[model samples]
Structures are given as C-alpha cells and as structure tokens.
Target: MFRVLGALTGTGGPAKLDQEEQSEKILSQAHDFEVALQAMDYVLDDHPGKGLQLLEGSGAKPKNEEDQCVRVLARGVIEFLEATLGFEASVMKKAAATLSEAQQLSAKRRQQFQKMGLKTSSLYPPGTEYAVTFAEACLLHALLMLFSESMVESAKALFKLRKAYHMLREILNDINAAKKKKGSAMYAQGNNESFASFVSADSSTFKSVDIPYSLSTEEQQNKELMELAENVYNMRKKRLEGAHIGNSPAIERLRTDLGIQALKDLPKKKEAKKPVTLSKAEIDKDQATIDEFIHSGVNLCFGILQVVLSLIPPAIGAVLSVVGFHGSREEGLRLVWRSTKDRNIHGGIGLLGLLFYYDGPFQFTDVDFDVPATSDGLKKTSSNDLDNSTLLHPGKMLEDALLQARALFPNSALWLLQEARMLSSRGRLQEAVDLMDSIDVSGIEMKQVRALMIFDRAMTLVHLHEFERAAEDLLSLLDINEWSHALYTYFAGCCYLENYRMCQMGLMEYSRIDFFKERATTLIFDAPNMLSRKKFMSKNLPLDRFMLRKVEQFKKFQSQLQLQDPLDAIGVSPVHELTYFYNGYNRMTEDCLKLSHKLLTEYHNPTIDAKEPNQELVKNLLTSLTSRRLGKVQEGCDMLDKNVLPQIITLQPDGKVKYIKKTEDPWAYPTALYERALFTWKLKGLDGLEECKMWLTRAQDYADDYELSARIGMKIKAAIDRLEG
Candidate 1:
C-alpha cells in the first residue's frame, strides 16, 4: 500500500521520502497550481507585468511535469501577448521558442508515461494530459510562426497546425471513448472513491497494482498522423509552388476528402489489457482537475481555429475547399461558447474571443439594419434578426458571459473595454467613449491593451466628429507602442484635415484653421515615408498599403489640378472615406450621417479636371453610401447608377457595358458596385436577392489591388452569404 501511494505521488519509494516530505510535496503542487491561476488572473485583469512577475517569482524550477507545463505556458502566453500587440519580429521569435520548449517537455513526459506502460486509450491516463499541453503548444507555436517574414516559415506553420489539429482530434476521441466505457470496472472503481479517502488516506495502507511493463507500439500511429499532415502540407505547397510572394493566398484549404481519409486511415491502437491503475481515491481526487483542464483547453484551441478559418472569404473558402480544410463558424462559436462556461484560463480567453468577434469582425462584415416587426407577419430583413432567428445571435449569451467574467475578475479593464464596444455598436458613442475614458490604463503593463483602448476611443471620437480630440488620441499611440507609426500618422493627419474642413465651414472654431491645415499637410506628406520603416511578414500592412495608395492618388490629383495647397486637392475627407472599410456608416447616427453628407458635398477642388474623373467619383461614392445609411435606398441607388457608374463604364455597340478602368481610383468602381448591391437589397428585400448577388459578384472582379480590397471582399462574401441564406 505504501509503495502504491508513493508511486502515484511520483516519490518512487516511501522509504526515500518521509511522511512530512510527502505532505509538503502535495501541498507544494497545490500551491503551484494556485499561483499559476493567480498569475493568469493578473493578466486578465490587465496587470500583465504583475502576472509575469508572479510567475517568475514562483520557483524557477518546476517540481513536476504539470507544474513545468503550467509555468512555460503562462510565460509563453505573456510573450505572445507582447508579440501580437507590438508586432515585433523579435518578440514573436521568443514566443515561438518558449512554446517549442513546452512541446519538448510534453513529449518527454509522454515518453515517461509510455515507459511506465500506461495505455494511451485509457480514461485519465497518467500522462495523457501532456498531449493536451502538446497540442496547445503546437497551436501557439504555429500561430507565432505566421508572424515570420519567410514563406518557408509560414509553410512550416501550416504543417504544424495540421499536426496539432490531429493531436486534438485524438484527445477528443479518447474523451469520447472514456464516456462510452464509463460503466467498466476500472472506471467504476475510480468513480466510487470517496473524497475523504483522497485527502486522509495513510500512505502505509495504499497498494500498487502489479502491472507488467511493455514498450508502446504507437510509432506507426505517429507516422500515420504525420503522413496525414504531410498530405495537406503538400497540397498547399503545390498550389503556391511558383506564385510570387503575396500574390497567392498564404493558406490553402485541406480537402474534406483528405480529412475523412485521415480519420479512416488512422485506426485506433489496441488498448493495453493490463494497464496500471491508481487507487479509487487518488483517481477521483486528480481526475476532476485533469478533466476540467484538458476539456476546456481543447475547446478553446479548437474553437479559435474554427472561428478564424471560417472567416475566410467564400471566394477563398471555395478555393480552400479544393485543397482540403474547412471550418464551420456556427460549430466554432458553439465550441467557444461551451469553453466560456468554465472558470479556467481557457474560459477567460474564450470570453474575450466572443466579445472581439461580436463587436469587431462581426460588426464590420454584417450589414443588416434594424427593421421594425409588422403586425401582418411580414418577414424582417435585418441581418441581426437573421442571425437571431438562426440561433447565431450572441446577445444574451455574451451578456451572461460578461456578467460572469466581471464577477470573477472585478478589476479587469478588458471586460470594460468590451462593454464599451457594445455601447458603441448600439450607437451610444459618447457613452462608449466615457466608459473607455473611465478605465485607467495608465498603469497597465500590457501596452497592447492600452493601445487598443486608446485606438478604440479615438475611433469612437471620430464617429462623434470630435476631430481635434481624435487626432490627439491617435498621436498619443506613438508613445505607447510601435505597432504601426504610419497608420497613426496618417490617421492623425486625416483628423486634422477634418478639423480644418470643419473650421472652414464654421462648424468649429475658426481661429485654429491655419494650424490645423499646416499640421495636416506636414503629417500627410510624412506618412508615405514612414511606410518603409514598418512592415508585417515583410509586406506593408493592409491599412498602410491603403494609405500609400490614397497619398499617391491625392498627389496625382493635386498635380493634375495645378493646386498649390495640398488641402485644396482633397475632394473628400479622407477619414470619412476610410471609414467605409470599418463599416462605420452602419453605426452612424442620423444626424452624424447628415453632417457627413454635408461635409462631403461642401468640399470641392475648385478646378475640376475632366481628365481626373477620380475626384468626382470619390465624392459621389461617399455621398451615395451616406445616403443609403440615411435610409434613402432608392436615392443612393440612383446616385450610383446615374452619377457614378456612367463615369466608369461605357455602353458598347453590342449593348454590353465595358468598364472604363482607371488606374488612379481602382477602388471606386468595385465599391460603387457593392454599395449598389446593398441599396438593392434594402429596397427589394428577398425579391432582389439574385440581383444583389450578381452585383456582389461583379464587385469582386473589379476589386483587384484596390485599396482595402480585402475588407471589401469580406463584405462582398458576407453579403452574398446573407442573400443566399
């Protein structure tokens, strides 16, 4: 009995360790677990430095595999946070290295368990928890690899993702198998154990089962998983074999058939007949923690992967299907929702993921407007209603989750940020700004979160037409982080330009007009030069690329019109023009829309050149979009058809329109098509679905290399999907 308890406790022998030492070891393990949890709590509460310090202060050497895994994972998470927030290559490299070390630790632990003759298929296998850790480390490492400037690294990341995916699937299979075998003798014995025995059992009375040790024959299975991973990797490699960098999609899909083949080809290994088993008390005590941790971790990692992969544009999604990978957004959301029900670190992250999706990407792509229900039982056409009816509405779920998170971590500013985002989405911009301002991020160690809060507030301020304040907030980001200096500079410049225009129209104080104009000119010209200084994966960020294009066009317009003042060449407020990418029009208040329309119409480059049709097209596009948001669907449609479309298309003798492509304003034609589609949908509802799809399809063709083309593509795909649904 003494031998069994000692073995279970990893002491090797009762004679080698005294009773006091045994108790101290168990207590120390518990303490380490608590410390890890506390560290995570600090991070979620926005005190990342405290979190890191707490983790590092807790003994540098881990006492056990679990402790080692927890410490490495916690530290790696901090590194990941810093890397993603700062977008620094060096930080990402460090994160990858830390996660790689975790993977190695997990592998070593797995080998130790295998040598102990533990069956991989057994419920709550001694070291199966390491598999969960391994998968998680692999997934995180793969994600960090994506930040690399090398395509080879990206390709390697894809292979790593496949391996992690399969590893997770295997763990899920083990869990399902355990559920099926719950009534077996081994399982029943573990279940029948008393909690009291677990806490108070005398080491002398415990007995070790005499199980024969044998080598595991799982090498073939590992090879099979690797082969499956290789197949998907090769498919992507073939597709991108000769493509220029950044030309082809970085990731290709794994075919569904290949996925099915993987499952079929990798048959489950036979379970060991004489598996070593811990006593019932020990099993019951440890199983609860193990189950919770493993289950939540799997759900969190797999759920995020699904959600991210599912976000691929349908055009890209279809192409991805040809190669092999597919993700269901609905299933992904469901899994993430499940993970949020736990109290673990996974649950906290799951909550953040849901909030970000509901407030950020979901808002950006979903274009449904609110429609009042009719007494006659007419169908409502709002996208929000559609999502609600389909059980995809996260409103109530998110509210409940936020409540739980706030209750658990009362000091967390992250939740407050999410709440503010909710307010902003509901058109309560000032309240959102106020809520954001109330959070004192001045002392927060995570500069990324601080930057995010500041950026969010600035954007909300822009929506409120507080241009001067918004400019100040944007410029302030430069001091906090170096993620994107060009983006900050360009946006600050646009804000100043907006302020100058407001002053010109007497909407703002006229005394600072010259100061605003001069600052705007200097910042705008300086923005293009800053681009070469910052890059992501060796390419200009999408927003930076868009800014560069806009600056070039602005200069060309100035040259053509022979304008001396750079401000005079601006036909539309560049800030307002860029807001389209953010789906800002959808969130605009009626009065704000009116103000925007007025400003867009009021600004004119005095000398109109017939040769430069882009300036007029830009004005019309902004006006038409604002008009649509203002509930003038037909008016918006007419503006696009009569005013904007005519300038970009020529009626051929065969009665087919040939697009008159302009290199300068390539974005105008496609964006106009997309706007026209939305207007059609609003006016015609279900009747106009086909027409909306046609227009959306045409928009895709015209979007090549256009500014914010990726964003436009996502909107186009989302609209088409909604129309089809």
Candidate 2:
C-alpha cells in the first residue's frame, strides 16, 4: 500500500544526468499532449476554427515507442473532437480509425514490456519505461471514444464495446492483484531499495536486470482509471435509461455476453486448492485502503456514485437494493459526509457534490430519472435542511476545504474554481464572483487551468445576468482560446442581446452599465474608464460582422420593446430559438406554431445550426389550420392527408404503413387522427361525413385514457355536428 500510494506523491529515486534528460524529453512530449487536450476541450466546447489550427500545428512526429504512443493518443483525441463538433459521419469514421491505431500501439507496448519481464509491483516516475500503465489508459480511452461515438444498433460496435468492458475488467483485476501483492510482507519489505536501483539503471541495462520485486506501484493510477471508466459508463447508461430511451437491447446483450465470457475465461486447475483467509486486522487494513481510494477526490468515483444515485431516484429506497446500502437521502448524504472528512482533494470534491445534491432543497429530486412504479412502497428519506445544526452546509465545507487543502496543494486552481462553482451552484453569484476576483492567477503556472478558471467565471457571470461583463470576459477568452472562438463569439452576441433587453426593461442602471464599460478597458491593462467608447452590446461589437443585419433588426425591435418573445429577438442563436419553440409547443401555447414558422423561415441557418428537435411538422400543422381558416377546404384536406397525418404512420419493413400505439407515438398518433377527422369533413360529398366520423372514432379508441384526448374528442364532435347539419 505504501509503495502504491507513495507513487502518487512523486517519491522516486534520483536519476543519472542522461536519464534525467530522457525524462525531460518525455515530459515535453506529455506536456504537448496535455496542451492539445485542453485545446480540444475548447474546440469541442466552443467550436472555434483557430483551435483546430492550434491542434494541427501542435502535432509532432514520434521518435520513440513512448512518443509514438502519445502521438496515437493525440490523434485519437483530435479526431474525437472533430466528430463531436462537426457531427459528421466521416469525422466519426476518422475518429474510429485513429483510436484503433492508438489501441494497437498501446497493446504492442504492453506486450513488449511484459516480454521484457518488467516488474509491476513497484512505483515508477511518469517518464520511466516501466510506465506502461499510461498505455493501458490510452487503450481504455480509445475504446471508450469508439463506444461513445459508435451506433448502439450496430452489432460490430456492440461487440467492440463488450471487448472494451472485458479489457477494463481484466485491467482492474490485475491492479487489484498488484495491490494485494504489494500489501503482502514479502513484496512490501525492502522494495524501496530495489525500486531506487531499478530507476537508476539505464533503460537498456534495466530490462535485462532481473529485479527481485513484485510488479511495482501502479495501483493508484489503476484505481483512478477504473473510477474514470465507471463514471463514463454510468453517465452514458443514465442517458440510455432515460424515459424517452429505455433499456437498449444492444447494451443489455453486451453486458450479458461480457458476464458469460468472464465466467468462461477463468482458468481451471487440477491441483488441490487451500482456502486462505485473512485475520481481522489484515481485513481492516485492506478495507481502510479501499475506502480511502474510493473516496479519493483525485478519482471520478465520487462523481460517478452521485450520478448513479441520481438515476436511482428517491422512491427506489436503495440503489437496486444492494446489500449494506440504501438509495435514501440519508445514505447519499452520509456517503458525502464520509468523504468530506478528508482534508485533501476528496474533501473539496465531496463538498462540491454535496452542494449540487442539497441545492435541490429537502431531497435530491432535480434530475428526471425513469423510476419504476413499484418503488412507491420503499421507505423515504429526506435531506437535512441547509441550516440544520448537525449537518455541514456547502458554504462551510467550501471554506474549510480551501483553508485546509491549501497546505497541501496551495497553488491549485481546481480548488479555487470549485469553490467559486459551489457558490454559483448555490445561487450566491455575487459572492462567487468576488471569490474569483480575489484569486491571484499570476501564481498559477498551468495556462490551461488558468484559462478554465476564467471560462468558469465568465459562465457564472452569464448566469448572474451580467451580460455585458460576461461579454468582455468572453471576448478576452476568445483572444486566447482559438478552439472556442465561434462559441465565445456566439455567447458574446447573446450577452449583447441580453444586455439590450435589460436596457429596454430598465433592469440595468446607468452606473452599472458604466461600470461594465470601465471593466472592458481594464482587461487590456488600459486606463480604467479612460476610453469613452460605445456601449458594448451584441450589435456594436466588431466580432461576427456577418450577423450585423440580424443584430440591427433586433436592436430596432428592442428599442420599441416590440419583441414580445425574447426568443423571437432576431440576434438570438437558432439553438436558443429552437429551445423556445420546443418549450412553447410542449406547453401548447397559442402562438407556438406561428413562432416556429417565423423561426424556420428567418433564422434557421443550416450552415451553423444543429439539426435536431425539428419543428417542420409543427409548421405544417399550422399551415393546414391556416388553409382551413381561409376556407380552402380541399387544400386543407390534402395538406392533412399528405403532411400532417404521416407522422403517426410507421412503415413496416414490407413498406406497409402501420398505425403506432399511443405509447409509441404518444403525441403524434392522437393529434394526427384528430386532424384527419377535421380535414375529412371538408372533403366532397356525404361520404366525407362518414369518413370524418370514422377517423374521430379511431382517435377516441386510441386516446381513451389520455386527458388531452378528451379535449380533442370534444373538438372532433363539434366538427362532426357542423358537417351533419
């Protein structure tokens, strides 16, 4: 345990000058990879073209096996980012290919190291030849990348995913075995001297030297990687198990196959086996280390556990009714409190997790989990109030973690950023802003971490409705963040529009607006309040000049306070517009269909907009209604039959149109039938009346238990009466 844990603290042997130079070279390569990762994040998050250029320019040819492994990983990540941002199948294919290369490279490295009889029990520094664990991480990451991007319906993808899971299970088992081995007296005693000797030896000489040691201390990173893997799986699983998408057959088959394969893969031994048992003391020590690792904030386990609990829902009582654990609020809170007791990374992370959990009020019921009806009988538990005397509040936890953890990781921007996030998550936006303002970023060395902190601050400001201030931050961020320029520019435009809205509503005082202007000047180290410039709104910014016409139109509407729907404001992104339309349609607002039509006609830029949550069906329905209002009876009938009615018609493999069940096409089926009934009444001859009644009857038949169906039925009856008269 000491061997494994000490590796995490960077305690290793002094290297020769030549070895140190090699280490330096490896560090430089690793640093390049890390920088590329950060740039990828920005590009994926913000969609800036410059980020892609930075990523492309940063690529360097590999000179060694280690460098080659890093190169593969970098290529995989870059391709993954491209696939995500572009949503292009070609990009996804490229990602799949790059990641496959990475996996092969990683596997080759692992085999090479294993053949050389490299000890896995002792701890090694990052740049050492013994750090084959990084290759394992690369392979795991590649597999996950493919799994995430690949279609679940594809049998080949499912097979690959199953293999990935199998690999992950094997890796974890090995790490656990290594942990157990290092814990034993034989491996633990006198291992430090062996490790020092192993590290000091030249790479060529070290492989041939038979070091008497257990596989060195790679267990800490193994545990961390396992946590990451679990977290990624759980997050993706949660999405699949959503009400709108439940119980994927592909995933289920993969899980079952993996389980069966695991059983089959176990070795059969003919020799008599002795049952070995541990003493109570030994058992306690093992449990202590496991517990410490589980709760360690350095890993993603805490986040994973929180997400798993959220998915379980409060009604379930215990998460899958597992032994020794309940899914109640008390159990969740208790788990959080246990981790918070630590003065290191875990404490800070636990506090942050607690804030999100507790911010939902008495119980953590914010996330919409697809909880089963059978869970109603389970015992309920309520979270303690924020002001409860016994419970530790989020505010106190953040304050403590900052003061306590500082002694260890004093220059950590993560801690400060998390603190700010906690405050923002709890709606203490001003306080969060002030805390961030106090952070002296000059002391932070990592440029990526510093940029991330600033980005977080900018987002927090946006949440606080300080759009002008947020815009300034975004503009500054855009200057440095080439990857996310488009995203930042888009947000900057949003901020301008929002600030304009505030001005129209008299929400922004002149002094506050002036204060924002002063901050913008100060960002470039200029004289504060010296430049009497134009008020920085979306319309005035020189950025994204192509959007000038749209901004100008929005400003005209803003001055007259004529933009009835903020969503309808011209300068707003199409993404926001779609969200507005979706919300309005769900609520069955009077102008929703018309609003959607206006958006579809005006600002639906195919080049820039994401193709999802399509509103064309709603627009067609509106057109059908409009034709009926204009007394174009035949046109209305034809529109309903052709455009509006087909939504509920699922085609069979044989090309026959099949009527979907109410459960399958919930909103579409009943609504389409009702529309069909209305349009049939407008058709020529008395047979039209009979056809109208038949369609209305079908609508009623499918919608018997639905409340909205009753309203549709009443309207259908009224139309039938008018036709019969």
Candidate 3:
C-alpha cells in the first residue's frame, strides 16, 4: 500500500505538477503576447489602424500578472506611436488611458512581487525576475512615451516624468546589487579550493580548459544576465538622461506656452504611498548609485525649468548664474564625470548636456560679437571664456568621456561619431576624417548612423579645404538618407561653389568646375527641405531657421555665378558685371562684415600677440571703404595703397605652383580706385577725367585677369564715353 501511494505521488516528480503547469502557462502567455506585439509594430508602420484589431481579440489577452502588464504596456506604446504620428484624437485619449493603466498595473505588480518574496529573494519561481523586470521596463518606457506625446506641461506630466525618474533609479539599484553579487560569486569560485584541487590533480584538464578562458553553463548564463541588465540600465539611462528635445525641451516649451508656475504648485511626488524598507546592507550598497541618480535627475528637471524661466521676454540667461536653477556648471560637470568614469554604461549624453550648458544654444547664423572700449583700451574677451571658467576645458572633458564611452561600447557608432565631432571641433580635421573612415559602415545597419558619419566626414573635409571630396561625401549621404534634403543639398552646393572659386583662382582645373557646378546647380535651387510638406521635424534631419538663409545665399551665389558665364568663357575679366551687382554686393558685404565681427569678437585672442595682422588688414579695408564713401578720394587712395593681400601660392595649369606677387584683394584695391575715379569725374567733369583715367588704368593692372576687372572696366568705359562723346 505504501509503495502504491509513493507511485501515485511519484515521489517528487509529479508532486508539483500544478505549479509547473501554472508557471509554464504564465511564461507561454507572456512570451506569445510580447512576440505578437513586436509583429504588430511592423504592421502598424503601414496600417496604424491595425493596432485596434490586436486589442479586439484574445490573441493579446493576458493569462497572468506578467502577461497583464505586458498587454497594458504594449497597447500604450502602440497607441502613443500612432498618436505621435498624427493619428486620431480618440486614439490619443486611449493611449493616455492605457499608459495610466500600465503605470498602476506596474505598481500593483511590484507589490504582488514583494508579497511573493520575488524581489527581496529568489524564492518564488524561475521566471519571477523576467516578469518583474519586463513589467518595470514597460512602465518606465510607457511613462517616457507619455511625456514625449504630451503637448502641454501639466502637473500630471511632471509627476509622471518624476515618477519615471525614481523608478529608473530603483531599477539601477537592483541591477547594481545583482552585479555586485555576481562579481563576488565569480571571485570566490575562481579562488575556491575545489577549483584549485581539480587544476592541481588533473594537468591535462588544466591544459584542455584554461580556468579563466572556460566558463561553465551557469557562469555563462550569469554573464549573459549581467549583460542584459547592463543593457537595460543603458536604455533607461538614455531616455532619462538624454538631451532629446522630448526630455527637457518639451517641458520647458510647455512652461513657456503656459507660464513659469504652471506646474510649480503641483505635488513633487504624485504617489502618496510610503516607500518600501530595505536592509542596511542594501542601502549601503546602493548609496553611491542612488546619489548619482538623484543628482542627475534633479539637474535635468530643474535645469530645464530654469532655462524656460530665463527664456521669457528679455533673455534672462545671465540671471541663471545668479538666482535660477541651483545646478551650477561645477555640479553639472561632476555628474557627467561620474557617469563617464563608470564602465559599461552611457554618459555621452550627460557630456552633451554639459556641452549645451557651456556652449549655449546653437544659434545657426546669429553669431554676435560685441566689444566695448574701456578707459585704458578695448577690453579683450572671447567666446571660449564665455563658459570655461568653472571647467578645466570642456573640449578635453568631452574627449575623455567619448574615449571612455568608446572603450565601454566598442560597437556603438554614436561614441565614434561624437569622438569624430570632438576632433573636428578642435581643428584636427585630418584626424577626424581618418577616424570616421576607420568605422566599418558596411556592417552598420542603421542608415542614419552611416549618413551621420558621412556628413561629419564631409564637414571635416570642408575644413581641410578638400571641397571635391566633401561634395562627394555629401552626395553619398544624400543617396542613403534624405532626412534634411535641403540641408544636404545646400552643403553640397557650398562645397561645389567653393571648389569653383578655387578653380577660378587656378588652384583646381577648369574641368573640375563644370563637374562641381553641375552638381551645385542640380542640388541648390530645388533643395528639398525648402519645399518640404512634412509637418514634423525629421529625427534624422534636423534643420534650423538659419538654413533657410543659407539656401537663400546659395541661390544668390548661383545666380551671380550664372551671370558671369559670358565673361568667364571669353577669359576677358575675373569680375562679371551683373544688372543687380550693387544689391548682391551690398548684401554680401553686410554678411561678410557680420561674420568678421563675430570672428573678431568671439574667436580672436588679443593676449596671444596683442597685434593681429588679419585684424589690421580688416581695419585698413574698412578705412579705405569709409573714406571713399565719404568723398575723401585722396585718403581712400592712401589707405588702398597701404594694404596688400596675404601671400598666396597659386597652382598653374601646367601642374606647377608659383608664389604670386603681394597685391590687394580685387574687391578692395580695384573697388577703391574705381570709387575714387568716379568721384573725381563727378566733381571736375572732363578735366577731372585724366586722374580718373589714370586710376582706372592702375585698377585694371591690379585686377589683371580676375573677375573684379570686368566690373571696373565696364564703369571706366562708360565714364570715358560720356567724357569723350
């Protein structure tokens, strides 16, 4: 009878059949649901309405707590994506509801896990961690999506974002604890007596299996688990700590659109529940991680609020240093440094935030340089000094962080791109190009990454004065990605036009000009962004207001070049006479002057030499122009005579290089002479024409075969015809 009873129970084999069945059911349901949701993503790409079909059937229904959480999270994610893409308002409302449900479900599920002793210990079951982690990640990602989709900065949005922040912090704590335990266990096993005894007893085993090189199944599983945890940490870190416009910019913009105190009166934590207690060991182990997490979170939150506060009405960016967000440059740098020093994690984003803090907003074309004269003289300052006081060097810090990030994530193209950017910023053009070239783009499946690398390389090439190479790179980028069609087309045009200028100066072959010109003409006028009907900014192609102006510049430049074809073909003169010559010239003059002023104010370091030859050249050119315009012909002539161009080497058509004689720039000396001659002819009529003629002759000599000569020649002949006829 006892034997029969043992057989009925099967000892331990069939005794826990119910529990095994339950676990298997839960796992199967959750896995199937997740896989179905992933498949639905591709379907939703083309047929977004198909998502509603998923919610209609038991195919996506939850069989257990984990499945329930996954169902809620996936539904929320799908709806949010649809809503962001301009889906129905009803869908957006449903998305909000789903996300709220997911958040509550996640919290309740955590409570259930705690009750089951899953989080504190591993007593519940084998799949407990997966359920808990998946539910938690789902909650965090949903909140992130909610915040991303939210158009207004309501008290609710801030609360959700803050909650997500705390949740991520907790997740990171658990991951760190697991990592510590794994590390300790690995260390102990490696140094254990059994391992040492085995190695000593079997020399052949030692030869066959190197102790460190060979990993048991369990050890490999642990290694994979740790890697997965690290990846989770990085994912959460990016969303929470990234500088995406969604993260802080949207919140800030919401404040601006609403008001500064729009969400200020809201409760700090939306949830009023008390926090769970942990052991002293747990607290001690996670203290550093907690501190770092909170530090970064606060900076991110209030830093955004402060920026918004300072942006209203009069630009109060200066007041931020005084009374705004308590986060200083020092604190921000410290946060980035902490992340950057850690291994197998991301801090490149934090570094970017620090850069934005220091470098200020990207102004596209609004570069302003102002210098005020003091009692002693003009006080010297620079844009570098604008933000470098509290930091050793932001550039060096960025480089160090990028290096650490690359070491940690060797396959991450982002780190490589950032390192390349840092190199380009520091004027290491060739090194930047080489670094970008070293990236194996063939294996990179993300077209955006490939496009970015190519674009960055092209920009670096531009700096290196390799216009043809730069244009080629831009073409390659456009072929792969049309993120900012206008932006790329404009850049390509700029490259080609720059090469055309070099060709005009005999530095490049005339045949090269036609190739580049064809490219520029095809791309410049019909730049895509200029005609973009899309409503939203492209994730891959970011464009600013200044880009519109750049397009205009390209148009004006191309039009001017077209007008010069007759003169260019005949080799009669360098300067082409256009009907609207003065308009283009004046407009370009203002633009050039603005650029010069910015360079002088922001980039010039007076302390280096106290006397800049380039600055002197600009001053001389300005003085000559001013005197000529003010009817002081003699003074203008004197100024023009004193100035000369920087020595330049010209590459001749015969493949030989020659040093040209020091002379004035065509725009400077020839223009000065022409202006003076015109004024003289105006004052004294035909008798004054002799001095005018002489000046014209001198201008012609200086202009030689350059484009400037044509304009001067046209004016001289017109005046001479009036005087003689």
- Clashes counted in candidate 1 amount to 8
lDDT of 1 by residue, 1-725 (tens): 35434443456622333333332333343344445655666677667777788787745445444457667877787777667656765677788889899888777656555445443222555456678778888887876764442334545666677777777888778776776776565444443432112221232232111111111234113343223323322322322221111222211211111112222332221132333222132122232334456777888888876665555444344445544675556566667877776655777778887776667623633645222233233343453232323323455556655654543454556666777777677677887787777657785557777788888888888888888898899989988775578888999999999888888889889999999999899888799898777766566766787788888867877897788987777666789876766557776788888999988876545533342467778878889888888878788888888888887666689966577777766666777887777777788876777878878877766666444554566666655544543
Candidate 1 vs candidate 2, lDDT winner: 1
Q: Which prediction has the highest TM-score against the true structure?
A: 1
Q: How close is candidate 2 to the true structure, as a TM-score?
A: 0.38
**Residue 136 lDDT, candidate 1, scale 0-100:** 81
lDDT of 3 by residue, 523-543 (tens): 654665544532222222223
Task: Indicate which candidate wins on lDDT.
Answer: 1
Clash statistics: count for each candidate? 8, 15, 4
- State the lDDT at 413 in candidate 1: 65
Off by over 4 Å in 3: 1-329, 344-398, 528-530, 533-725
Could you tell me the C-alpha RMSD of candidate 3 in Å? Answer: 22.7
